[model samples]
Target: MQCPVWIFAACQSLNNWQQEAGSLPKIGVLAIQGDFLEHGKMLDAISMDWQEVRLPDQLDGLDGLIIPGGESTTIVQLMDIYGFRDTIKRRTREGMAVWGTCAGMIVIARKLLDKRPEPLGLMDIEVSRNAFGRQVDSFETEIHVASIPGDPVHAIFIRAPIVTNVGPEVEIIAEVEEGKPVAVRQDRLMATSFHPELTNDTRFHELFCKLSGS
Candidate 1:
């Protein structure tokens, strides 16, 4: 039987990603907190080899690392308990690409409006935690990313943070409001206020893979 148009298109897109990405890089998903399994599934769909990163030691030799969306405070606390802060910084300095989603974005920001969570100060942006209000205010929308071409990316924001201030080196990839940035990238580091793993689209994953030099 012939597949539906949407299914065919999805398969075509996945195949195209596999071809363009060429030799998928070994990626690690921070599994200490949040919806890490969802990120893992997305990686799997793209035929990328990945593992759950709970300890700092597991970061060795990884081409890329993804900090999944979860409670920012809890993720940071677990990172401290597991001694991941310094190691992650070292790895990133060694040219390992990093992507942060939702709460992960807040964890990597240079400055956060909230004082509770001590960010990694990796990305050159100031974030306002829970900028979209409470969980009840969560919503999704289609947005155009500057680097990723074709269709607009489907972004899901759940108590998401917003980039209130961007530094000179940071590149604003996507924005919800005229001046509010929802996604930003700096060198090998990237961050998104929305949860791309929750969506069926794998373009973000593909983009990260390319960024990691897959």
Candidate 2:
């Protein structure tokens, strides 16, 4: 017997809609600290909608989240105080895409080189804070991210963390200085030791948006 063609067509259309609906996925930036406003402006430059996520409730309905660069200890303290640590972990477990930059990378790492507040431990990587040097040592360089198109990306490293090791599941997206990985990805989670929001480029954000289903 021949199946109804209209039913199959309608189902296909519905699937397409579901997929395309996320083309402009709603994103959230952790506004508890760091350059979240810069991230917001970057999102605007890319023509995507984003909000400052200052509370756990703000995490709801977000396709993806960005934790910007800031003082890792203070950020962790605030997250703990506001009960965002566990909430974010749960959301990531449910397949919410997340990207952490600079101090944000440290906050999400699984291991730290120093004794400090516990991070979200969502990314399976070991990090040494300020590996590049102190604030005075901040500098810029161009590196190619395999996932991003076009020319090399201009990376701004300000008191950056260094990824000393990565789990077997992690993928190194970019690196510098004798194969030191600076950007990495594991499933829906991404982390970079440099601040992409500080630049005018949108490739990293665009890549993250794609990961978040945008």
TM-scores for all candidates: the values are 0.91, 0.89
Residue 16 displacement in candidate 2 (angstroms): 14
lDDT string for model 2 (115-182, tens) is 57688889999999999899999999999999876689999999999899999999999999989999
- Superposed on all Cα atoms, model 1 deviates from the true structure by an RMSD in Å of 2.7
Poorly placed runs, candidate 1 (over 4 Å): 1-22
Q: What is the lDDT of residue 143 in candidate 2?
A: 98
Question: In lDDT terms, which candidate is top?
Answer: 1
**Candidate 1's TM-score:** 0.91
Worst 10-residue lDDT window for candidate 2 reads: 1-10
User: What does candidate 2 score on TM?
Assistant: 0.89
Q: What is the C-alpha lDDT of each candidate?
A: 0.89, 0.86
